[model samples]
Target chain A: MTPGRKLLGHIALLVPPFGWLGIFYLGSLSVLLLSAFWQVDAMSGEIVRDWTWENFRILFSDTTYTVIARRTTGIALLVTVTDIILAWPLAWVIARKVGPRLKLTLLVLVALPLWSSMLARIYAWRLILGHDGVLNWGLRLVGLPDQNVAFTNIALWIVFSYLWLPFMLMPMVAALERIPASLLDAAGDQGATPWQVFRTVVFPLAIPGMAAGSVFTFAVTQGDYVAPMLVGGAGSEFIGNVVYSNVGVSGNVPFAAAFSLVLLAMVAAYMLLARRFGAFDAQ
Target chain B: MGPNVLMWNTKDITTAPTSWSIIYDKAYAGVITVPDNPIQIADAALYLSHTKPELGITDPYELTQPQMDAVVTLLKEQRALVKKYWALASDEVDLFKSGDAHVGAAWPYQANTLRAAGVPVQDIIPSEGATGWADSWMISTHAQHPNCAYLWINHVMTPKVQAQQALSFGETPANTKACAEMDALQPGSCKQYHADASPAYFSSIKFWKTPVRQCGNGQNTCLDYSAWQRAWQQVKQ
Candidate 1:
């Protein structure tokens, strides 16, 4: 085909996806951002389309929003870090030490939880973590004191970590598998210790993968409100919870939109930082 | 419609809690729950309206600035005692069934579900009163089958159907004549839910409504629904 025809073919290929993104994703996002500047009529509970910054002003001035935003970010960071620590060893074992057949099994095992309903899994956690729940029952059998971690930040942490662990594991496993066995063999032959080989070779190469995983773990935890609603205790309000309540319960769409923009800004800033740290470098 | 009632584990409490104040008691700290909504602020106001008469809180939904401030302060104090604020009836049921919460605010559905699941639980409208919802069926103007909608409404409004719904859902029927029908359907179920009990019983319940700044007493100084939402968020935090 001629170069002009090839260019036309390429444009045709891009049209469907670009059109979709433009109409749905970008279009809806723009509408959301625009609504954030509108105000809600307090009496009638109607969205007044006039431009105003009252929603943003309230968010900035009220210390409650700040505290909620901080708490949410803190939980997201903690979940991401916990997933990394938990997934690294498992991913490494599957990618390196395990046989191909077992590696596939291990990968499936990591992903098994995702197949079930999220609400069902969170409810299962509720049963496991409750005061007289399975965890406490096991503790009694083992002669250990019950932790009583249900409905606390600790419970939220456990659920969030569990929910996002697979996202972290998959990328790390892929990165680890890409490392040639000859490189490790050479490192071992050059008098490098096991710890040194890991620290110098495996760890550096896995940074990009870890960063990629962190993006998912961080973003998902940051925006999730359902887990918090079902499992979170008092004072465990996330930014998502605040935004959801505003929209669903309060019927204050403008404020909800504004609150969402705040969350979007936070996620965007985190993505920029992650990108700066070479998260997308492999791509 | 069912109201929010105080529910406690029957096995844990020898004497059922008789007042809403039991929720605020320090003894139940870390084992009590309430609804995770701004509407719950009215419950706090309802308690204060009876206990702290000086606040002059006649209507829970139409609270002036001072009354609202008092309610907010009371809720912040109650916050420490709350184990979790449940958003769903199922959440409350699971909490009670799993013994995560010993006592808290709940709906009749939660109590009924827990009882059916073999969890020993009881619910009551406390001495200070309770908050509840009243639902009505409305047909849209643009509805394709307006006649059918009206027929359905008329059918449900009949004493027999009303009693059936009231007994099944554990709520008082709007049709007072349904009391006899409810008794026939299920012995003592009408009295059990206080159906056709007394005018005072109905008056005691502060029906749930959106809080607006315009007070019933013609005062515009009351806090609106957004304020309640913000205050509830602050209280939870």
Candidate 2:
């Protein structure tokens, strides 16, 4: 093909996807950003389209929004920490300890939950965590007192950790598997203790993987309104819940858009902090 | 106006709960579930309309700032009792089925689904009345077949069809004549739903709608839906 023709072909290939993103993704985001500065007419329940900072004023001035943001961030962080704790050992076992045949099986098992519907999994957790659910029933059978953890922050924490565990596990497993066995042997020859080797070599090397996984756990938990609604109890309102209610139930698009911008700012700041910690350094 | 209702586990209480106050009762703390919507403020307003008449809350959807504050305060107290605010009908069904929630605001559909699953549950339009939604089928102006759409609407509005939908959905049939059809389809179903009840029974229900500043009583001092939404977030927090 001629050079000019090749250049035209490359441009043609890029145009569709770039145009689509420009129109749909960036276009909608710009619209949302624009709407955030607009005001809603109280009497008519319509967007007035006049530029104003009233929405931001309400969001920043209100303690309710502050409390919600704090709660959402706290939950997201908790879920991420929990997933890391749960995934690290499991991922390590699959990567180093387990046989090749078992490693594939275990990896598949980690990913199995993703295949099913999220709502279905959440509902299953609801049943297992309820007052008279299997968890309590088993406790009673063991002669312990029944526990009611359903519809609380504890349940939200459990469900979020469960839902996002695979995201953390897969990345950690990949990172751990990529570490050369010779490196570990070298450490052993130098009389390095197991814990010391892990702390100095394994842990720091896995930070990038954990950070990659956290991108999923943190973002999903921060923005998830469904899990909280299905499993969360009173006082479990997340930032997503507030945005959802405003957009869906109240039809207050402007305010919802404004609230989302606050959430976007927070997530962006969190990502930057994560980057500072070398979470994405490997990439 | 909507299919939403107050549902409770019949096995938990000897007698059926007949008042909205059951949800606020301290005994049911951490076991009650209400809706997680801004429109739910109407339920609190409905309760206040009967209990606090001096507030002059003529319409639950139209509440003055003071009246709204009173409702929000009451809801804040009730928030401690709520296990969760359900956003979906099936979630409430699961709540009752698993015995997670003993009582709270629910949809008639959830109650029916639970009972069908052999869960001992009952729903009521409590003594203080309740809030609901009136659903209507609409066709877009860009419809490809308006004639077919009209035919579909007419078919659905027929007594038999209305009865089938109303019974299945656990909602009131718009067609008054559907009462007999409902009884014929499922004996006592019409009575169970108050399908042929007096106008007072219908009037007791405050239909769900967007709350604007212009109160239904011609007052302009009422809080809008956004205020309720923000207040609800605060209450839950």
Candidate 3:
């Protein structure tokens, strides 16, 4: 086919997806951005056009800014680190040692939890992490402190880590699988320890995949409201809670909008930094 | 001559406006706005208890653990079809405007907005009647639009407007004549809304003094708010 016709084919294929993205995601975000500048009448619930920087001022000055930012950033970093540690071994096992059929089966097992609703999974975690929940009940049988043991920050971190594990594992497995067996044999032949071989050969190759996984874990957990609401205590209240209460409790949509924009900026800066550091190298 | 009307303990109903009250009219389901501030609950409870006890609600003064449990159970059962458990008066206004709620336990100002939005909303004073807060329509010390604002106040308080507002907004009109006019609209149904200016309605609906374990009085030890919070959490769990 001529280059022109080929371009036409590609354009036709891209149109529907492009239209969907433009109308829904981009359009909604534009409106949300507008809402950030608008002020809400305290009594009337009316959106007044008194364009003021008061909303942004609150975002910086209020206690909500510190509490929400600290919790969101803390949880995001923790989930990212935990995912990396847990994913590396599982990815190595799946990519190198397993039979093709067994590998596929194990992959299915890892990915299966993703099929469940995010809300249902959170509720299930709550059951396991409640004060009188399954974990405490199990611990009580073993003669542990049954009260105030579960339902802490530790419980929330565990749930968040569990939720995002597959995101980390899948990418690492894909990256590791792409590495030829000859590369490992070459390292082994040079009298390098398994640790050294891993450091030089495996680690560098997997950095890009690890970075992608980090983005998912960091972004999602940073913005997650429901997990903290369902599982975490007062200390676990994140930016999501601030955003929610601003809109619902205080009826201060402009401040909430400003807060969300700041969050978006933070995530954007993180991604930009990751890219600058060569986090992605598409093969 | 119209029966005398006395306003009692409640939040600044002016904050909510009067247009968001239709939710209560549809379901006849008892409503509860939560994080359960005792005074707010008490006002609604006392109002309901005296004027419309057939709803099987207890007085705020008499509210105890068992009563709370019953209320919770009732709320849970009606969760599927409640106008809503309104957190903000704005939310209540949205519910009224969208017709999601027919009779709401809402702020008066919210009900006013809904009426402006053409929803035929009313804050009904139930036969066992309504409870709302003290929000005087006064000229602010820093008044900008003084005459217009005063006109706005007088217009709202006018007898015909008050009657229409009582029927439409679901609140007890301050004007006794308006309340009477509302009573005449559906005769027997209006009695509960008058509430007899009961002492229970007035004194009982004070700001919820969260019980402190070591209250200054040294007579009786009150359970702390933390205990109540823990208990509430356990119940949810």
Best by lDDT: 1
Predicted complex 1: DockQ: 0.86
- Candidates sorted by DockQ, best first: 1, 2, 3
Each model's chain A TM-score? 0.95, 0.97, 0.91
What does candidate 2's lDDT look like per residue over B35-151, in tens digits? Answer: 877788888888889888999988888888888889889999999898888888887887887888889888788888998999998887777777878999999999999999999
CAPRI quality band, candidate 2: medium
RMSD of each: 1.8, 2.7, 15.7
- Tell me each candidate's i-RMS in Å: 1.0, 1.3, 15.2
What residue runs in model 3 are displaced by over 4 Å at the alpha carbon?
A1-12, A147-149, A277-280, B1-202, B207-237
Candidate 1 CAPRI grade: high
Q: Give the best candidate by DockQ.
A: 1
A200-258 per-residue lDDT for model 2 (tens digits) = 88998888889888988998799889888778888888889888878877778998999
**lDDT (0-100) at residue A162 of candidate 2?**
94
Best by TM-score: 1
Worst 10 residues of 2 chain A by lDDT: A274-283
- lDDT tens per residue, model 1, A1-283: 9999999999999999999999999999999999999988877788899999999999999898898999999999999999999998899899889888998888888889999999999989988999988999999999999887999999999999999999999888878888888989999999999999999998988888899899999998999998898889988999888888888888888889999999999999999988986788764
